[model samples]
Target: MSSFLTLSIVQSALELGCIYALVALALFVSFSLLNIADLSTDGCFTLGCAVGAVVTMAGHPFLAFFAAMAAGVASGFITAFLQTKMGVQSILAGIIVNTGLYTINLMVMGFSSNINLFNTNTIFSMAKELSESEVYRSWYKIIIVVCIVLLVCVFLAWFLNTSLGLSIRATGDNEYMVRASSINPGFTITVGLCVASAMTALSGAVLGQYQKSCDINYGTGQVTIALASLIIGESLIKKGSIFKRVIFVVLGSCLYRFIVAIALRMNLPAEALKLVSAVIVAIAISFPYLKEKAGFYKHRRDVMRQASKNV
Candidate 1:
């Protein structure tokens, strides 16, 4: 490939990777920390895009971003309420919220199934307007996104070590124990879900601005993709420090994007991308089990060989 082509591919991968990393971080909070599946991610992502795009079209790009985050928080809170107050299962609550958000997002977008932000003032556009050089304009959006991701990682790391964060973690680890300690596990769960949803919403808002459009199905199967990135990051880092783990989550997002880029370069069909994501997640999830099984077989084989020799 030409140098320019390679550069373009790399740039695209980096941008997408950052977005994926945000989603993965959100998933890490919900799945790894809160122990909730939180399937509302798919709808919340689309909701962010829709909210951002509509508000951008109305001449308030920054407000649009925050609005999207607010919408995501609301969605998350609803799911939490359903699970905690109404006695609904977490997975079921997520599904219900996810299903409801489709209509809500559509309503937010004025019944349009999709909206384009091209030429409209977006957060990135505003950033470009502030910078004088064309080169700066081209790179500023990505730089801002990287900064946001880094800030989020640092904040999350610090938060996880705090008393409230510990309580949240405890809820995930052992709800009964947390309840016994007089900590409200439900409240912790709600807070965690809200934070996770906000992260996802931020990702969607940025991605929509970057692409200059918002599509209704933009977040299809996002949970699997986020899980894949999280697991891949965890496997690669294998460290216990919360700070390092968060950094690894971002790295894993980039790695997942790189893999997808390579797969695209190989000319994989667009229709198969979901399958690829599923396969990647499956392999990551099953790796420990597979390793244990292999070790067991190897040990058994060694014991049998030793017995035969003795006989």
Candidate 2:
């Protein structure tokens, strides 16, 4: 336990938490705001990593960010098209896109399963170069990610306040009401998914650059992880403005990563990580319901006790 609390391990967990917080934010948009279940997240994340890594290796680290986001936009557009035009269910559209993205991601990686960037110049490297002292250098990654997350949170807060953004949130709450009110729910859904997917891709790009490599399975089970983070965040902050919620999302991601770090310290095997993720998700999902159940039982017991005293 003490070893897990070491500075280096804590820093590593913080880095991972910051990276994955983007995905949690993405889920907040698609799942919470748009009421969409986008199962294509894993593939989209890998696609971003592959595209970003390939482009970064070509000596264009900055361009890699936009390139990866563009790929994510294309992926999002296809998923939206399938749902809006082809009449596919939202979940099915995501599955179809996720499946097709696997091949596309592979192609982007030059048909290889992994791309090593051992000597590659990535965004992290660029950030590190901007720092002077060794201490500042160690903090570069966190600073970069924190700045990006802050910008994103501010942008999202403003966006959600806009008319179109309000329409997106309304569409999620009641599509028929939005439709009857002269707003196109389809358009709102499309835009929301695109924005969400782009955010997820950005997360992958950051993770890939930070790790200094890209693997075919880099994004496996990422959606579950994001969902868990989101749920944990919601648990922490039940009701708040968008800005507050976004902050909680970041906090939740950090907490989730911290838990994983502790588990790893306990000598949990790599193969069991997914199961651990599933359990965390289960607890998060059931927390509210379980709490309510306990409350109900307590109330009933209290009522019976009161009646017995009166008798």
Candidate 3:
């Protein structure tokens, strides 16, 4: 590729990566910290997109973002209530909320399956208005969003190091132990889910504004994508400090986007995209396991060789 084309691809990858990183961070809170598989992300994301699109169309771009966040929090609350109060499994509760949000998102979008804000005032447009040069205007939106996401990640990492954050981590690691220490596991789960869903909502709002449209199917397979990103990030980074982990996650998201962009440029068949994603995730998730197995085989081979030589 030409240098300009390479630069363009890198730019697009970074922008898209930042967006996906937001979703992955949300999943990290629930999956990595809360020990819950939240399927509600798919619905909540779409709900946020729908709310943002509709509100922006109604001449309330800023409010639209918060509205979407509120919707996401409500969805999280419902799932939490189901799990904590109604005695449903966490995964099941997420499924219930996700299913419900489908209809709710449609309602929020004026009962339509999709809403296009192609010519409406969106967050990107607002950013453009605040900029002078066309190039700066084009870059400003992504830069602002990336900065916000990084701030959130930093805040989360710091929070996780706090007393309350420790409690949340304890709840994930050993709920029984946390309860023995007089901590409420239910509360921890609720709080984690709330934060996670809010992040997901923010991501959805940005995505809607970025694309100038919101579709019901926009969030389909989102959970898988988030999981894949998290797995890839975790695999790439050494588990040391919280700050390092957060940074690694962001880097992983960027790397994942770059890979996808390269695949697209190679003219990979659309039908193979899902398979590619699955393969990537599987390799990431199984890396440690594979390493262990390889070590075992090597040890066995060494022992056999030594025995044969002695014989």
Candidate 4:
């Protein structure tokens, strides 16, 4: 491929990576920090997109951001309420909310499955307007996504150190300990899920605006993608401080996107595309355990050999 073509592909990957990083960060908040799987992510994401698209259609692209987050917070609250107040299991609560959101998302979009925003004003369109005289005009999406991702990362780093943040982490680490400390695990979980869902919704808003369209199916399997990216990111920065680990999640998102881009270019059989994602996720999830097992076997073999020599 030509240099220009390569650069184009890389740029596409970067845009995708940056967008997905927001979801990974969302997962980080719930899965890593709050110890909640929050299976409602896929539905919550589409909810944001639908809500954002509808709101932004009314000539207030900026307001769409907060509106989507508010929708997300509501989704999180419902799920949390089920878990905390109704005594539903965490996973079951997520499933219940996720299924319920399908209708809710459709309702938000006026019972439509798709919304077209080709002529609408979006953050990217604004960026393009400002960068009309600059070479960065073509890269407006990347610029917007990177800025949003950075802001989320910074905000999360700050939030993760606050008293509430510490309580959330403590609840994640050990709910029993949190209860004994007079801190409410239920309260911490509710806050954590709300925050995570907000981030997820923000990402969906960005994606909807960037694509200039919203489709009901846009959020399918997003949780799996975010989980893979999260595992890959945490592996890359295994020993980092909280801030470093959080930032690396963005890097991992980009890296995951790059891997997918390359795979797509390889012209894999159409039937195998889904399988490819599954394999990637499986590797990301199991590689560490496999590595440790391999080392253990190697050490056992070496010990056996030494014992034979001594005998």
lDDT of 3 at 13: 83
Q: For each predicted model, how many residue pairs clash, with residues at least 3 apart or on different chains?
A: 0, 0, 0, 0
Query: lDDT by residue for model 3 over 130-159, one digit each (tens)?
Result: 859879966886687788788889888998
lDDT of 2 by residue, 149-180 (tens): 78877888899889988998999998679868
| Better model by lDDT: candidate 2 vs candidate 3 | 2
Candidate 1 stretches greater than 4 Å from native: 1-5, 129-138, 293-311
Model 3: lowest-lDDT 10 consecutive positions: 1-10
- Segments of candidate 2 deviating more than 4 angstroms: none
Residue 16 of model 4 has an lDDT of 88
Cα deviation in Å at residue 238, candidate 4?
Answer: 1.7
* Superposed Cα RMSD, model 1: 2.6
* Clash list (residue pairs), candidate 4: none
Candidate 1 per-residue lDDT over residues 19-97, each given as its tens digit: 7788899998999988999999999999888888888889988888788889889988999999999999999999999
TM-score per candidate, in order?
Answer: 0.91, 0.96, 0.92, 0.94
Q: Candidate 3, clashing residue pairs? A: none
User: RMSD in angstroms, all models?
Assistant: 2.6, 1.5, 2.3, 2.0
TM-score: which candidate is best? 2
